[model samples]
Target: MCPPEHFTVEYAINPWMDTKIAVDGALALKQWASLRDTLTDLGHLVHVLDARPGLPDMVYSANGAFSVDGTVYGARFKYPQRAGEADEHRAFYAEKTDNWRFFAPEQVNEGEGDFTYLPGAYGGIVLAGYGFRTDPAAHAEAQEILGRPVISLKLVDPAFYHLDTALAVLDDRHVTYYPEAFSPASQRVLAQLFPDALLADRSDAEAFGLNLVSDGRHVILNTEATAMGHKVRAAGYLPVHVNLSELKLGGGSVKCAVAELRP
Candidate 1:
């Protein structure tokens, strides 16, 4: 995880960002540190990525790249503001990891932000979100590069720009997401794919409840998602709350701060 030492909402890419509200840098750092520590305390190996001086949004490491089975598909950012991050992430993986094959696709894609793996009986299914930051064409590229079946899901909500912000993979068969964020066709596809998935209400979704990460048991989510927390607990998962209000200023939360290396 990269510290939010340089995090600020200087530009508005998503609806959540408001440049008028001054972000408390110190508080952001504290919250980020707490999140990192919490993940480590949960017995997960946390790796620190050095944050660049100018790339403020680099703290949202999940957008950097998508790693699966030792192969890293470097991100091709849609916005110029975050374009430089792709190279930095590629270099890091190249220099730090051993035997890691990297694929740099020309099409626009926001790495893990749009690409999420669904593990189950139909394991290795990649749910790729598009119509926002990611281009729909990249789904085929991802399938070819990763050698996995890709299901294209069209995102319709600006607030849920990335799939991670709208959908949370809780376990093999279950997922939690805001139905309105996706297109009607995509919603039908999701229902067919995950019939028993938990559906979050508008209030919970506005609180960024679906922007979570789970270890199949413990779910880490935004503190404001109280109702969603109760729902998660009822679904047999421990909901761990973390206050990332400052980070929310950048249209990101718990899942955005993390980049999983799936091996």
Candidate 2:
């Protein structure tokens, strides 16, 4: 079983999001400590990003960028208010690990939360959720850059604006997603790719419950979704739930809290 404290964290400081549910100083600190404790228990290398003063809700936007093929492609967010986030990540990319690279598209595209990797034995496929975060052209650009096929889909729900917020494919064949958020065309494409995807119910998804981290039969999920937690366990995978309600208000969850660097 993988423990919790093994993750490396890089979070943005945001007071607006925090105060939404009254996530103030002590409350925020306690919540972060809980998250850190969970990560440590999971055997992940945790690294907390230094809080950037005057930055309001940058962590939520960070979920858009993802790391793939040893490169970290920063996101181009839709909200103009989040434009500065791209530059923030650019600086982080430069000073951080050399293994992390950057991909900035002149066109608009949100990165990781909008896209999920389908790692296959032969090669890998990427599912880009289009509409709010990722543009159709961005999917094509990403495919060209990665030299792989990127399947694009329309993300229907406002609450589940990003792909990660709606769906999570854990094992090679098993996937957890809110069916209502996907279009028929996208569903057909997904069937072509993942023939037998397990769908997650909507109520659980709102809590960022369906966003999962997996290592083979082992799965990591947010603690808030007790029903989904039961489902994951029923599927025969060891489930590790970490409480991150504070982070969720910032538009992120457990999946966004860490960048997985190992297979």
Candidate 3:
């Protein structure tokens, strides 16, 4: 996780980012610290990536790299603004730990922003989303890099730009997502893959409710997702609410601020 020390909407990259809108710098920092604390409180180790100047979106560390079993698949951002941030992540990995291997990709893939791992014995299959920030070719490239099957899912909605924005992997066997954010074929594919998956309503989805993190038992989500919270409870997971309104202005919340390293 990286601190929102330099977070701001300098330019509109996604639907949520509006140049006219103002960001509360102090509030964003406070909210980010709270998010980090929440994960630590849950017994999860939190790592910090130093925020670089001219890279405000670096706070959304999930876009930096996708790590699994000590190997990291580095990101290649579609936009020039975030292009340098991926290399910074590789540097962080190089400096912090040497036991792991890192691979810089030739494809335009926004790391965990498009890749969601579905757990399996040997590093599971990756549910990869495309047609937005990630390129379809990145799926095959990521598959070869990670040595895992990459299932391509297409995203059609501009609001739900990244896969993590519209879907939350609840656990190894379960997931929750907003169906409208995906293509009809992708929606059908998801339904076939996990029939019992929790479906987020329009209200919940717009509130960025599906942009959450779950540890199979505990779900960390935004405070505005009341309906999704109830569904999470019904699914036997504890829902922990966190207000990321300041960060939301930049098109991210709990899940975006987090980049899980499965080493």
lDDT tens string, model 1, 2-108? 88888998999999999999999999999999899889999999988888888889999999999778888889999999998888889878885676899998889
- lDDT (0-100) at residue 76 of candidate 2? 81
Q: Candidate 3: worst 10 consecutive residues by lDDT?
A: 117-126
Candidate 1: residue pairs that collide: none
**Per-candidate TM vs. native?**
0.97, 0.82, 0.97
Global lDDT of each model? 0.90, 0.65, 0.89
Off by over 4 Å in 1: none
Error of 3 at 235 (Å): 0.6
Error of 1 at 6 (Å): 0.7
Tens-digit lDDT track of model 3 for 119-165: 84235778889988999999999888888888899999899999998
Better of 1 and 3 by TM-score: 1
Worst 10 residues of 2 by lDDT: 1-10
Task: Please give the clash total of every predicted structure, in order.
Answer: 0, 22, 0
lDDT of 3 at 243: 90
